[model samples]
Target: MFFSFWNSVVFIIICLILFIRFDTSDSGANNLHLFDANNAAEMFGNDVFFEILDPEVLRYTYRARPAKDFGVTFNETFYQREALLVPVEPPDSCGWPKNAHEIEGNIALVERGDCSFLSKTIRAQEVGAIAVIIADRRLVVDDDFYIEMIDDKTERTPQIPAAFLLGINGHMIRKTLKELDMRYAVVNIPLNITFVSFHEMNQPPWMIW
Candidate 1:
């Protein structure tokens, strides 16, 4: 009789432990939502604004490449230059384990291919990234590419700033760093800006007017 009583007590204890763990996990997730940029800014006196670029907007593109390919022999410059390279995989499997962390404050260097541009930007934003730069894998292709974010089933639309660069551009940027005996350098290019108009209709004025 004593053995059975002890067994019951042990089972009850285990159940209580599991319940507490589950509750804690749920609470943690809830806390994360509260830290979202929009909410955090409001609570902390930080200013946040939305900048929506129509189909056309003036933007710049940058590049990344292997240093060895370029004869450049500088290491200090390269280290000073930091670009958040996004691995070509699911957010959970991306090459940079701290991709989100780095992107929050620095420029995000993302690999082209696999998943939509939107998915990459959204993932970056989750980690606090302010801007995004995508690198193409085709080093030889010299063409302009468009970036689109993946929405999946979620209603949230990614509204982060983003840009794209050719594979060669990336390589050249790396090369420039090496030539200057630097690990990296900032490559800025000017983009053309175009304004778009929104259409709205007004009701006809009443005869009394």
Candidate 2:
């Protein structure tokens, strides 16, 4: 009995050591913590990626965190949508966008600020946007960093799905559009990169590894 107990304890200690090593491994670090490949989809709120398809100059993928309480929650297993990524006039989208005509029937890319995330999403929805992607206004050095876009405390609820994109990724996308004198970029939102290996991902050139 004593020998069996000792063996069990030794096995548990080995398992713990292996788990710790795997958790902090180099490959794990590259997968981004919020969407770690080894973790379950529910562990990270079923996070997803936005993949640019048109204007080859900007064909890359970026992470997005979908809202938990409003609209449709993205499913990593099967959810996917292709749409034109249009920028809202006045950018902040605190009020209705002047480019409502352009915003209608496409994904509105609004800058983060001047209003709650839900407010921005609602403004885009009013213009007939199928979905909303609110990009961070301030750029953080960490490429994997992003904000959890939660709903605002109000009776007015948006009916469309929304997600948050990192500031640097947002800036790069907008800058590419400006340089190309374009109004929108064709994109596949919430592209499932859950099982995709880090090296196989079509990550932007600016993204490190």
Write the residue-wise lDDT of candidate 1 on 52-163 in tens digits.
1211121122222221111222122223223333332222313433534444554455656666555655666566654555555554654533232334555546545554
Root-mean-square deviation of every model? 20.8, 7.4
lDDT of 2: 0.77
TM-score of each: 0.37, 0.73
lDDT of 2 by residue, 19-111 (tens): 889877966767676565553333434666778888899888877777767766555443446678998888898897888999888888888
Deviation in angstroms for 170 in model 2? 0.7
Model 2 stretches with alpha carbons more than 4 Å out: 1-45, 76-82, 139-146
For model 2 the TM-score comes to: 0.73
Clashes of 1: 18
